[model samples]
Target: MRIVHDWLGPIELPEAPERIVSLAPNATDTLFALGLGQRLVGRSAFCYRPAGVLGLPVVSSYTRVRWELLASLRPDLVLVSTGVQRDLLQALFERGFPVYPLPLPQSPYGIMENVALLGALLGVSEAATRLAQGLAERYARLYRALPLRRVYLEFDLGGPITVGRGSYVDEALRHLGLQNIFSQHPQSYFVPQLAEVPKRGPDLFIYEPKPHRSRPREKVEQLMAERGWRLPLVVTGGDELAHYGPLFFGYLERLVEQIRGVLD
Candidate 1:
Protein backbone atom coordinates (compact mmCIF):
# COMPACT_ATOMS: atom_id res chain seq x y z
CA MET A 1 0.00 0.00 0.00
CA ARG A 2 2.94 2.33 0.65
CA ILE A 3 6.27 2.76 -1.15
CA VAL A 4 9.46 4.06 0.44
CA HIS A 5 11.88 5.36 -2.21
CA ASP A 6 13.64 8.68 -2.66
CA TRP A 7 13.28 10.99 -5.63
CA LEU A 8 16.97 10.73 -6.52
CA GLY A 9 18.55 8.14 -4.26
CA PRO A 10 17.70 5.16 -2.11
CA ILE A 11 16.10 5.83 1.27
CA GLU A 12 14.21 3.13 3.14
CA LEU A 13 11.27 3.99 5.33
CA PRO A 14 8.12 2.29 6.55
CA GLU A 15 5.38 1.57 4.04
CA ALA A 16 2.82 3.41 6.12
CA PRO A 17 4.05 5.49 9.03
CA GLU A 18 1.51 4.62 11.72
CA ARG A 19 2.15 7.56 14.02
CA ILE A 20 3.16 10.92 12.56
CA VAL A 21 4.02 14.12 14.36
CA SER A 22 4.05 17.34 12.36
CA LEU A 23 5.85 20.25 14.02
CA ALA A 24 5.20 22.99 11.51
CA PRO A 25 1.85 24.39 10.49
CA ASN A 26 2.65 24.24 6.81
CA ALA A 27 3.97 20.73 7.22
CA THR A 28 0.83 19.58 8.98
CA ASP A 29 -1.30 21.21 6.26
CA THR A 30 0.66 19.31 3.64
CA LEU A 31 -0.01 16.02 5.43
CA PHE A 32 -3.72 16.78 5.63
CA ALA A 33 -3.72 17.66 1.94
CA LEU A 34 -2.31 14.20 1.27
CA GLY A 35 -5.36 12.70 3.08
CA LEU A 36 -3.28 11.34 5.91
CA GLY A 37 -4.95 13.40 8.60
CA GLN A 38 -6.03 10.18 10.29
CA ARG A 39 -2.39 9.29 10.92
CA LEU A 40 -1.46 12.52 12.72
CA VAL A 41 -0.85 11.90 16.39
CA GLY A 42 1.02 15.11 17.19
CA ARG A 43 0.64 18.57 15.67
CA SER A 44 1.87 22.08 16.24
CA ALA A 45 -0.28 24.56 18.12
CA PHE A 46 -0.17 26.78 15.06
CA CYS A 47 -1.68 24.11 12.83
CA TYR A 48 -5.25 25.36 12.69
CA ARG A 49 -6.40 24.27 9.26
CA PRO A 50 -8.47 21.25 8.23
CA ALA A 51 -10.61 22.32 11.23
CA GLY A 52 -10.54 19.32 13.59
CA VAL A 53 -6.77 18.98 13.78
CA LEU A 54 -6.72 21.64 16.46
CA GLY A 55 -7.76 18.93 18.90
CA LEU A 56 -4.70 16.80 18.16
CA PRO A 57 -1.93 16.60 20.72
CA VAL A 58 -0.09 19.93 20.60
CA VAL A 59 3.66 19.57 20.94
CA SER A 60 5.04 22.72 19.30
CA SER A 61 4.39 26.32 18.59
CA TYR A 62 6.00 28.67 16.13
CA THR A 63 8.88 29.23 18.53
CA ARG A 64 9.19 26.01 20.51
CA VAL A 65 8.12 22.42 20.90
CA ARG A 66 7.62 20.63 24.19
CA TRP A 67 10.05 17.77 23.77
CA GLU A 68 8.72 15.94 26.79
CA LEU A 69 5.23 15.91 25.39
CA LEU A 70 6.43 15.00 21.90
CA ALA A 71 8.53 12.12 23.15
CA SER A 72 5.74 10.76 25.28
CA LEU A 73 3.50 10.58 22.22
CA ARG A 74 5.92 8.15 20.59
CA PRO A 75 5.31 9.13 17.03
CA ASP A 76 6.80 6.80 14.44
CA LEU A 77 7.58 9.62 12.02
CA VAL A 78 8.35 13.24 12.81
CA LEU A 79 8.17 15.88 10.05
CA VAL A 80 9.28 19.45 10.46
CA SER A 81 9.82 22.44 8.26
CA THR A 82 13.11 24.26 8.56
CA GLY A 83 13.86 27.29 10.79
CA VAL A 84 11.04 26.97 13.31
CA GLN A 85 11.93 24.05 15.52
CA ARG A 86 15.55 23.14 14.88
CA ASP A 87 16.34 22.94 18.58
CA LEU A 88 13.47 20.57 19.24
CA LEU A 89 14.55 18.49 16.27
CA GLN A 90 18.01 18.14 17.75
CA ALA A 91 16.54 16.92 20.99
CA LEU A 92 14.27 14.51 19.16
CA PHE A 93 17.24 13.04 17.29
CA GLU A 94 19.40 12.82 20.40
CA ARG A 95 16.61 10.88 22.07
CA GLY A 96 16.62 8.41 19.13
CA PHE A 97 13.57 9.73 17.35
CA PRO A 98 13.14 9.41 13.60
CA VAL A 99 12.57 12.87 12.19
CA TYR A 100 12.44 14.36 8.72
CA PRO A 101 13.52 17.95 8.45
CA LEU A 102 12.32 19.64 5.29
CA PRO A 103 14.10 22.68 3.98
CA LEU A 104 11.99 25.72 3.35
CA PRO A 105 10.09 25.40 0.12
CA GLN A 106 11.55 28.47 -1.55
CA SER A 107 9.84 28.11 -4.89
CA PRO A 108 6.41 27.17 -6.27
CA TYR A 109 7.80 23.95 -7.72
CA GLY A 110 9.69 23.42 -4.52
CA ILE A 111 6.45 23.56 -2.56
CA MET A 112 4.99 20.96 -4.89
CA GLU A 113 8.12 18.89 -4.48
CA ASN A 114 7.58 19.02 -0.74
CA VAL A 115 4.04 17.89 -1.43
CA ALA A 116 5.47 14.89 -3.23
CA LEU A 117 7.70 14.27 -0.24
CA LEU A 118 4.66 14.44 2.00
CA GLY A 119 2.85 11.99 -0.22
CA ALA A 120 5.65 9.51 0.14
CA LEU A 121 5.67 9.90 3.88
CA LEU A 122 1.92 9.35 4.10
CA GLY A 123 2.11 6.37 1.76
CA VAL A 124 -0.49 8.12 -0.37
CA SER A 125 1.62 8.96 -3.40
CA GLU A 126 -1.22 8.95 -5.88
CA ALA A 127 -3.44 11.19 -3.79
CA ALA A 128 -0.55 13.56 -3.14
CA THR A 129 0.31 13.72 -6.83
CA ARG A 130 -3.28 14.56 -7.65
CA LEU A 131 -3.32 17.45 -5.16
CA ALA A 132 -0.07 18.76 -6.54
CA GLN A 133 -1.55 18.61 -10.04
CA GLY A 134 -4.56 20.61 -8.89
CA LEU A 135 -2.29 23.32 -7.52
CA ALA A 136 -0.24 23.34 -10.72
CA GLU A 137 -3.38 23.74 -12.78
CA ARG A 138 -4.60 26.58 -10.59
CA TYR A 139 -1.25 28.28 -10.94
CA ALA A 140 -1.29 27.87 -14.70
CA ARG A 141 -4.76 29.30 -14.90
CA LEU A 142 -3.86 32.30 -12.77
CA TYR A 143 -0.69 32.89 -14.73
CA ARG A 144 -2.56 32.97 -18.03
CA ALA A 145 -5.66 34.86 -16.86
CA LEU A 146 -4.14 38.08 -15.58
CA PRO A 147 -1.44 40.63 -16.20
CA LEU A 148 1.14 41.53 -13.56
CA ARG A 149 0.09 44.13 -11.04
CA ARG A 150 2.25 46.47 -9.00
CA VAL A 151 1.21 44.79 -5.79
CA TYR A 152 2.64 44.78 -2.29
CA LEU A 153 2.17 41.61 -0.16
CA GLU A 154 3.42 41.29 3.39
CA PHE A 155 3.71 38.09 5.40
CA ASP A 156 3.44 40.11 8.57
CA LEU A 157 3.22 43.82 9.32
CA GLY A 158 4.12 43.58 13.01
CA GLY A 159 7.71 43.81 11.80
CA PRO A 160 6.87 45.16 8.36
CA ILE A 161 8.24 41.97 6.86
CA THR A 162 7.67 40.94 3.25
CA VAL A 163 8.54 38.32 0.67
CA GLY A 164 11.17 38.94 -2.02
CA ARG A 165 10.68 38.52 -5.76
CA GLY A 166 11.72 34.90 -5.98
CA SER A 167 10.28 33.76 -2.65
CA TYR A 168 7.60 31.06 -2.70
CA VAL A 169 4.80 33.53 -2.02
CA ASP A 170 6.10 35.88 -4.67
CA GLU A 171 6.34 33.00 -7.12
CA ALA A 172 2.70 32.22 -6.34
CA LEU A 173 1.86 35.88 -6.81
CA ARG A 174 3.55 35.68 -10.19
CA HIS A 175 0.82 33.27 -11.26
CA LEU A 176 -1.80 35.99 -10.97
CA GLY A 177 0.58 38.32 -12.77
CA LEU A 178 1.04 39.98 -9.37
CA GLN A 179 4.38 41.49 -8.48
CA ASN A 180 5.45 42.05 -4.87
CA ILE A 181 6.81 45.46 -3.89
CA PHE A 182 9.08 43.69 -1.46
CA SER A 183 10.40 41.72 -4.39
CA GLN A 184 12.51 44.81 -4.73
CA HIS A 185 13.70 44.38 -1.16
CA PRO A 186 16.91 42.51 -0.49
CA GLN A 187 16.71 38.72 -0.38
CA SER A 188 15.97 36.85 2.87
CA TYR A 189 13.81 38.58 5.47
CA PHE A 190 13.34 42.12 4.22
CA VAL A 191 11.74 44.57 6.66
CA PRO A 192 10.29 47.63 4.97
CA GLN A 193 10.32 51.00 6.64
CA LEU A 194 7.09 53.00 6.79
CA ALA A 195 8.82 56.00 5.28
CA GLU A 196 9.96 53.93 2.32
CA VAL A 197 6.36 52.94 1.51
CA PRO A 198 4.94 56.27 0.41
CA LYS A 199 7.47 57.80 -2.00
CA ARG A 200 6.92 55.18 -4.68
CA GLY A 201 3.31 54.52 -3.56
CA PRO A 202 2.74 50.95 -4.68
CA ASP A 203 -0.50 50.77 -6.66
CA LEU A 204 -2.09 48.64 -3.92
CA PHE A 205 -0.89 48.15 -0.35
CA ILE A 206 -2.14 44.60 0.13
CA TYR A 207 -1.35 44.30 3.82
CA GLU A 208 -2.33 41.33 6.00
CA PRO A 209 -4.11 43.09 8.81
CA LYS A 210 -4.59 41.23 12.05
CA PRO A 211 -8.30 40.46 12.22
CA HIS A 212 -9.16 41.93 15.64
CA ARG A 213 -6.25 44.30 16.03
CA SER A 214 -4.44 46.78 13.83
CA ARG A 215 -0.89 46.06 12.72
CA PRO A 216 2.32 48.04 13.21
CA ARG A 217 0.96 50.37 10.56
CA GLU A 218 -2.23 51.02 12.54
CA LYS A 219 -1.38 54.66 13.16
CA VAL A 220 -0.36 54.96 9.54
CA GLU A 221 -3.65 53.42 8.45
CA GLN A 222 -5.46 55.99 10.57
CA LEU A 223 -3.36 58.83 9.18
CA MET A 224 -3.97 57.50 5.69
CA ALA A 225 -7.67 57.27 6.44
CA GLU A 226 -7.38 60.98 7.00
CA ARG A 227 -5.71 60.62 3.59
CA GLY A 228 -2.11 61.49 4.51
CA TRP A 229 -0.63 58.65 2.41
CA ARG A 230 -1.48 58.23 -1.29
CA LEU A 231 -1.52 54.42 -1.46
CA PRO A 232 -4.73 52.40 -0.98
CA LEU A 233 -5.13 48.64 -0.58
CA VAL A 234 -7.16 45.51 0.07
CA VAL A 235 -4.85 43.51 2.31
CA THR A 236 -4.56 40.53 4.67
CA GLY A 237 -2.31 38.95 7.30
CA GLY A 238 -2.67 37.52 10.78
CA ASP A 239 -4.92 34.44 10.87
CA GLU A 240 -6.73 35.44 7.68
CA LEU A 241 -3.62 36.09 5.62
CA ALA A 242 -2.14 32.74 6.56
CA HIS A 243 -4.01 30.98 3.77
CA TYR A 244 -0.69 29.81 2.41
CA GLY A 245 -0.55 25.98 2.21
CA PRO A 246 -3.62 24.54 0.48
CA LEU A 247 -5.47 27.82 0.73
CA PHE A 248 -2.69 29.53 -1.25
CA PHE A 249 -4.80 29.37 -4.37
CA GLY A 250 -7.55 31.17 -2.46
CA TYR A 251 -5.15 33.90 -1.40
CA LEU A 252 -4.23 34.42 -5.06
CA GLU A 253 -7.84 34.72 -6.24
CA ARG A 254 -8.67 37.26 -3.53
CA LEU A 255 -5.52 39.17 -4.41
CA VAL A 256 -6.41 39.20 -8.08
CA GLU A 257 -9.84 40.69 -7.42
CA GLN A 258 -8.43 43.23 -4.99
CA ILE A 259 -5.85 44.33 -7.53
CA ARG A 260 -8.57 44.55 -10.12
CA GLY A 261 -10.63 46.74 -7.81
CA VAL A 262 -7.67 49.08 -7.61
CA LEU A 263 -7.04 49.09 -11.35
CA ASP A 264 -10.68 49.32 -12.39
Candidate 2:
Protein backbone atom coordinates (compact mmCIF):
# COMPACT_ATOMS: atom_id res chain seq x y z
CA MET A 1 0.00 0.00 0.00
CA ARG A 2 1.22 3.49 -0.87
CA ILE A 3 1.01 6.22 1.77
CA VAL A 4 2.42 9.73 2.08
CA HIS A 5 4.03 10.06 5.46
CA ASP A 6 4.62 13.57 6.73
CA TRP A 7 8.32 12.90 7.11
CA LEU A 8 9.02 9.96 4.75
CA GLY A 9 6.98 11.33 1.82
CA PRO A 10 5.42 8.91 -0.67
CA ILE A 11 6.39 5.29 -0.02
CA GLU A 12 5.04 1.81 -0.55
CA LEU A 13 4.54 -0.40 2.52
CA PRO A 14 3.79 -4.09 2.54
CA GLU A 15 0.15 -5.11 2.86
CA ALA A 16 1.13 -6.92 6.04
CA PRO A 17 4.68 -6.64 7.29
CA GLU A 18 5.55 -10.15 8.40
CA ARG A 19 9.18 -9.62 9.46
CA ILE A 20 9.51 -6.28 11.19
CA VAL A 21 12.40 -4.46 12.89
CA SER A 22 11.66 -1.57 15.24
CA LEU A 23 14.54 0.79 16.04
CA ALA A 24 12.62 3.13 18.33
CA PRO A 25 11.40 2.33 21.83
CA ASN A 26 7.98 3.88 21.22
CA ALA A 27 7.47 1.97 17.96
CA THR A 28 8.60 -1.25 19.59
CA ASP A 29 6.17 -0.72 22.46
CA THR A 30 3.32 0.15 20.07
CA LEU A 31 3.93 -2.95 17.93
CA PHE A 32 3.70 -5.19 20.99
CA ALA A 33 0.57 -3.39 22.27
CA LEU A 34 -1.03 -4.02 18.86
CA GLY A 35 -0.30 -7.77 19.29
CA LEU A 36 2.31 -7.78 16.49
CA GLY A 37 5.26 -8.63 18.71
CA GLN A 38 5.74 -11.99 16.96
CA ARG A 39 6.36 -10.19 13.67
CA LEU A 40 9.39 -8.35 15.05
CA VAL A 41 12.71 -9.90 14.11
CA GLY A 42 15.07 -7.21 15.37
CA ARG A 43 14.95 -4.34 17.86
CA SER A 44 17.19 -1.58 19.17
CA ALA A 45 18.98 -2.19 22.43
CA PHE A 46 16.79 0.41 24.12
CA CYS A 47 13.49 -1.37 23.26
CA TYR A 48 13.42 -3.07 26.62
CA ARG A 49 9.70 -2.96 27.40
CA PRO A 50 7.09 -5.66 27.96
CA ALA A 51 10.24 -7.59 29.08
CA GLY A 52 9.66 -10.06 26.21
CA VAL A 53 11.15 -7.76 23.53
CA LEU A 54 14.55 -8.15 25.17
CA GLY A 55 14.65 -11.66 23.68
CA LEU A 56 14.71 -10.21 20.15
CA PRO A 57 18.04 -9.72 18.43
CA VAL A 58 19.43 -6.26 19.08
CA VAL A 59 20.37 -5.00 15.63
CA SER A 60 20.52 -1.31 16.44
CA SER A 61 20.98 1.30 19.14
CA TYR A 62 19.76 4.85 19.51
CA THR A 63 22.23 6.25 16.94
CA ARG A 64 24.08 3.22 15.58
CA VAL A 65 23.07 0.06 13.72
CA ARG A 66 24.70 -3.29 13.17
CA TRP A 67 24.48 -3.38 9.40
CA GLU A 68 25.47 -6.99 9.02
CA LEU A 69 23.06 -8.20 11.70
CA LEU A 70 20.20 -6.10 10.32
CA ALA A 71 20.89 -7.36 6.80
CA SER A 72 20.86 -10.92 8.06
CA LEU A 73 17.48 -10.36 9.71
CA ARG A 74 16.02 -9.36 6.30
CA PRO A 75 13.17 -7.35 7.71
CA ASP A 76 10.29 -6.58 5.35
CA LEU A 77 9.60 -3.37 7.31
CA VAL A 78 11.76 -1.26 9.61
CA LEU A 79 10.14 1.16 12.06
CA VAL A 80 11.93 4.20 13.41
CA SER A 81 10.92 7.45 15.08
CA THR A 82 11.80 11.02 14.18
CA GLY A 83 14.13 13.39 16.06
CA VAL A 84 17.34 11.52 16.93
CA GLN A 85 16.67 8.78 14.35
CA ARG A 86 16.09 11.03 11.33
CA ASP A 87 19.55 10.45 9.88
CA LEU A 88 19.27 6.73 10.51
CA LEU A 89 16.01 6.63 8.57
CA GLN A 90 17.63 8.38 5.58
CA ALA A 91 20.55 5.98 5.61
CA LEU A 92 18.22 2.96 5.62
CA PHE A 93 16.07 4.48 2.87
CA GLU A 94 19.10 5.10 0.67
CA ARG A 95 20.27 1.53 1.25
CA GLY A 96 17.00 0.28 -0.33
CA PHE A 97 15.46 -0.77 2.99
CA PRO A 98 11.76 -0.41 3.69
CA VAL A 99 11.97 2.13 6.52
CA TYR A 100 9.10 4.12 8.02
CA PRO A 101 9.64 7.15 10.25
CA LEU A 102 7.15 7.89 12.98
CA PRO A 103 7.00 11.55 13.83
CA LEU A 104 7.83 12.75 17.35
CA PRO A 105 4.52 13.41 18.99
CA GLN A 106 3.91 17.03 20.01
CA SER A 107 0.91 16.20 22.19
CA PRO A 108 -0.84 13.23 23.79
CA TYR A 109 -3.23 13.15 20.82
CA GLY A 110 -0.28 12.87 18.45
CA ILE A 111 0.84 9.75 20.27
CA MET A 112 -2.59 8.19 19.79
CA GLU A 113 -2.52 9.18 16.09
CA ASN A 114 0.80 7.40 15.60
CA VAL A 115 -0.73 4.24 17.09
CA ALA A 116 -3.49 4.40 14.48
CA LEU A 117 -1.04 5.17 11.66
CA LEU A 118 1.19 2.26 12.59
CA GLY A 119 -1.83 -0.04 12.73
CA ALA A 120 -2.94 1.04 9.26
CA LEU A 121 0.51 0.39 7.83
CA LEU A 122 0.46 -3.17 9.16
CA GLY A 123 -3.20 -3.91 8.14
CA VAL A 124 -4.55 -3.85 11.69
CA SER A 125 -6.63 -0.70 11.47
CA GLU A 126 -9.44 -2.02 13.66
CA ALA A 127 -7.18 -2.93 16.55
CA ALA A 128 -5.27 0.32 16.25
CA THR A 129 -8.46 2.37 16.34
CA ARG A 130 -9.64 0.53 19.41
CA LEU A 131 -6.32 1.07 21.17
CA ALA A 132 -6.33 4.77 20.40
CA GLN A 133 -9.91 5.10 21.62
CA GLY A 134 -9.07 3.24 24.81
CA LEU A 135 -6.08 5.49 25.47
CA ALA A 136 -8.24 8.57 24.95
CA GLU A 137 -10.78 7.22 27.39
CA ARG A 138 -8.13 6.50 29.98
CA TYR A 139 -6.67 10.00 29.60
CA ALA A 140 -10.11 11.55 30.09
CA ARG A 141 -10.55 9.65 33.34
CA LEU A 142 -7.33 11.10 34.85
CA TYR A 143 -7.93 13.26 37.96
CA ARG A 144 -8.09 16.91 36.97
CA ALA A 145 -9.86 18.45 39.97
CA LEU A 146 -6.72 19.11 41.95
CA PRO A 147 -6.29 22.79 42.73
CA LEU A 148 -4.19 24.55 40.13
CA ARG A 149 -0.58 24.78 41.17
CA ARG A 150 2.49 26.18 39.45
CA VAL A 151 4.76 23.21 38.65
CA TYR A 152 8.42 22.90 37.73
CA LEU A 153 9.21 19.52 36.08
CA GLU A 154 12.73 18.39 35.33
CA PHE A 155 14.22 15.31 33.71
CA ASP A 156 17.70 14.01 34.49
CA LEU A 157 19.06 13.15 31.04
CA GLY A 158 22.61 13.47 32.38
CA GLY A 159 21.65 17.02 33.22
CA PRO A 160 18.60 19.08 34.09
CA ILE A 161 16.27 19.01 31.07
CA THR A 162 12.78 20.48 31.21
CA VAL A 163 9.76 20.40 28.91
CA GLY A 164 8.09 23.45 27.44
CA ARG A 165 5.48 24.16 24.81
CA GLY A 166 4.91 21.61 21.98
CA SER A 167 6.00 18.64 24.07
CA TYR A 168 3.74 15.77 25.13
CA VAL A 169 4.94 16.13 28.71
CA ASP A 170 3.92 19.75 28.80
CA GLU A 171 0.53 18.91 27.33
CA ALA A 172 -0.01 16.06 29.75
CA LEU A 173 0.80 18.29 32.71
CA ARG A 174 -1.68 20.87 31.47
CA HIS A 175 -4.32 18.17 30.98
CA LEU A 176 -3.95 17.36 34.68
CA GLY A 177 -4.76 21.01 35.54
CA LEU A 178 -1.22 21.89 36.54
CA GLN A 179 0.51 24.93 35.08
CA ASN A 180 4.05 24.33 33.89
CA ILE A 181 6.42 27.10 34.96
CA PHE A 182 8.19 26.84 31.62
CA SER A 183 5.09 26.39 29.48
CA GLN A 184 5.68 29.68 27.68
CA HIS A 185 9.12 28.65 26.45
CA PRO A 186 9.12 28.14 22.69
CA GLN A 187 11.39 25.10 22.65
CA SER A 188 10.21 21.61 23.58
CA TYR A 189 13.17 20.48 25.68
CA PHE A 190 16.01 22.59 26.99
CA VAL A 191 18.41 23.11 29.87
CA PRO A 192 16.57 25.14 32.43
CA GLN A 193 18.18 27.95 34.36
CA LEU A 194 18.50 26.76 37.95
CA ALA A 195 18.07 30.30 39.19
CA GLU A 196 14.78 30.64 37.34
CA VAL A 197 13.42 27.53 39.00
CA PRO A 198 13.22 29.11 42.47
CA LYS A 199 12.03 32.39 41.02
CA ARG A 200 9.14 30.61 39.33
CA GLY A 201 7.62 30.02 42.77
CA PRO A 202 6.31 26.58 41.83
CA ASP A 203 4.05 24.92 44.35
CA LEU A 204 5.43 21.50 43.38
CA PHE A 205 8.58 20.05 41.83
CA ILE A 206 8.25 16.95 39.60
CA TYR A 207 11.66 15.40 39.05
CA GLU A 208 12.11 12.43 36.69
CA PRO A 209 15.39 10.86 37.63
CA LYS A 210 17.55 9.38 34.89
CA PRO A 211 16.57 5.77 34.26
CA HIS A 212 19.19 3.21 35.38
CA ARG A 213 21.13 6.02 37.07
CA SER A 214 18.80 6.00 40.02
CA ARG A 215 18.85 8.84 42.57
CA PRO A 216 17.12 8.28 45.88
CA ARG A 217 14.63 10.74 47.39
CA GLU A 218 17.17 11.84 49.99
CA LYS A 219 19.70 12.64 47.28
CA VAL A 220 17.08 14.58 45.35
CA GLU A 221 16.24 16.53 48.48
CA GLN A 222 19.89 17.35 49.06
CA LEU A 223 20.25 18.57 45.46
CA MET A 224 17.21 20.79 45.82
CA ALA A 225 18.42 22.03 49.20
CA GLU A 226 21.69 23.13 47.61
CA ARG A 227 19.69 25.34 45.32
CA GLY A 228 17.90 26.86 48.34
CA TRP A 229 14.55 25.41 47.18
CA ARG A 230 12.35 23.50 49.60
CA LEU A 231 9.25 22.89 47.53
CA PRO A 232 7.16 19.72 47.68
CA LEU A 233 8.88 17.13 45.46
CA VAL A 234 7.79 14.06 43.51
CA VAL A 235 10.61 11.99 42.05
CA THR A 236 9.47 9.82 39.16
CA GLY A 237 11.93 6.92 39.09
CA GLY A 238 11.57 5.50 35.56
CA ASP A 239 11.34 6.40 31.88
CA GLU A 240 7.58 6.72 32.03
CA LEU A 241 7.60 10.47 31.30
CA ALA A 242 10.65 10.30 29.06
CA HIS A 243 9.21 7.47 26.95
CA TYR A 244 6.41 8.14 24.47
CA GLY A 245 4.62 4.81 24.52
CA PRO A 246 1.18 3.40 25.42
CA LEU A 247 2.55 2.87 28.92
CA PHE A 248 2.94 6.62 29.26
CA PHE A 249 -0.77 7.05 30.07
CA GLY A 250 -0.52 4.56 32.89
CA TYR A 251 2.41 6.50 34.27
CA LEU A 252 0.47 9.74 33.98
CA GLU A 253 -2.35 8.21 36.00
CA ARG A 254 0.10 7.32 38.72
CA LEU A 255 1.57 10.80 38.54
CA VAL A 256 -1.85 12.33 39.14
CA GLU A 257 -2.23 10.26 42.28
CA GLN A 258 1.26 11.26 43.42
CA ILE A 259 0.62 14.94 42.83
CA ARG A 260 -2.65 14.71 44.77
CA GLY A 261 -0.83 13.23 47.71
CA VAL A 262 1.91 15.86 47.58
CA LEU A 263 -0.56 18.75 47.41
CA ASP A 264 -2.96 17.42 50.02
Local distance difference test, each candidate: 0.68, 0.89
Model 2 lDDT per residue over 1-264, tens place: 787877668888788889999999999999999999999999998898988898999998887999999999999999999988899999998888899988899988888999998998898999999999999999988647567899999887788999999999998898889999999999999999999988888999998886666456777899998888989999886688989988899889889888889878
Per model, state how many residue pairs clash.
Answer: 6, 0
Residue by residue across 70-158, what tens digits does model 1's lDDT show?
88898888877665466766666567777777667666677678788777766688988899899888767777455655766555546
Pairs that collide in candidate 2 are none
Q: Which stretches of candidate 2 lie over 4 Å from their true place?
A: none
**Worst lDDT window (10 residues) for model 2?**
210-219
> What would the TM-scores of all predictions be?
0.83, 0.96
Model 2, position 125: C-alpha lDDT score? 96
TM-score of 2: 0.96
Best by lDDT: 2
